[model samples]
Target: MKAVSLVPSLTEAVAVTLPGVLAGATDWCTHPADLDVTRIGGTKNPKLDRILALAPDLVIANEEENRAADLDALRAAGCEVLVTEVRSVPQAFAELARVLAACGAPGRPRWLAQAEAAWAALPEPPARRTAVVPVWRRPWMVLGRDTFAGDVLARLGIDHVHAGHLERYPRVPLDELRAAAPDLVVLPDEPYRFTAEDGPEAFPALPCALVSGRHLTWYGPSLAEAPRVLGEALRAARR
Candidate 1:
């Protein structure tokens, strides 16, 4: 079975969900070995032909990630395409269901059950607000309103300070950050890594934590593992 997953978050989900869907080993391949592919969300990639050359039985893309022209070109090339635009974790579950249905795989009910149970098993968070900085410095950005990251934060019952105040991924000035006075400023390690020692001296007065971007940012089956990890981190920080 050939599957093409365009977005990294969905690709990671497929990698985990395939075993449950196919009920066995399925040879899955993705454009980027990792999430750093330029076209996905990084720099610039002018190569749609590479994906076409994969000669996939099916290609899954997100409306937010895949350009319409690219999808049209893929359709023209006779590839069956499934598109998912997931802005929140609940939407992510729906998208996963769509991919499973398109793949003609069984075991979705079981998968969804497990996912639901796992989500329920998550512990209630400490009653403190949290702000996650999904991008590292250079421009210094944070997940604002209407983003997957913001949704994940909400699921944890942790408030994102910028949720209603700004656009998605707004560039936050250091002064604004000082004013928000978040309980925690989480710097995720992707797009760039911000080590603990690398904490901006300019913000030394702020409470900060350098964290795994994959855990906080990936919205998929990977989510099954996130709440526990995030919960532990927050618990430790509370002490």
Candidate 2:
């Protein structure tokens, strides 16, 4: 079963669960560090010609990460594109299983089971903290309503201040974000690299937690350790 994964998390899931099945992948599919598939391009702008040349049996993508026009074009060319929608942790697990099954895995992978168990094992937080999660900084876009990252953070007892916003990723002015009065400012490394020196200064009055984008955003093997990894970062910043 030849496949091309446009989502990095899905690419890792497929590569780890069923090795050598990937015929091509976007340039951003960086997990497994040693992945040797043909580089198609970025998720938002995949090279359709290159992907078509690979003649994959299936092209794996996500509703949020992939462009609708690109998926339509692939389908128009007779390539089977399996698009996934994962807005919450539960959805992520379900979608991962479905994508893997479509990729011809004999059964559910052990990592998926491990990830489920890990999240299930998390004890209820003693208290919940409100945070403003910034994904990008130039125009200052934040994680708003119904985002997978927001759901992941909510499970870890960090509620997004913009969770009630009308848009999923709203571009709020930096001044407005600072005025939101969140208990903490949670920053992830990707979509924008928010380092200690780079991001913390902006939220000088609030504690800033620099979290890993892969753990906070990606919904694959990283989910297994997200609770622990993200918890430590949040705790360290609070202290």
TM-score of each: 0.80, 0.99
For model 1, how does the per-residue alpha-carbon lDDT over 143-214 read when each residue is reduced to its tens digit?
777877777767777778878865777888778887787777777666577777665464677666666677
Highest-lDDT candidate: 2
lDDT of model 1 at position 66: 61
lDDT of 2: 0.94
Q: Cα lDDT of model 1 overall?
A: 0.64
Clashes of each: 0, 0
lDDT (C-alpha) at residue 220 in model 1:
62
Q: Kindly report which residue pairs in candidate 1 clash with one another.
A: none
Q: Runs in model 1 with CA error above 4 Å?
A: 19-46, 109-112, 132-134, 200-202
Badly placed stretches (over 4 Å) of model 2 are: none
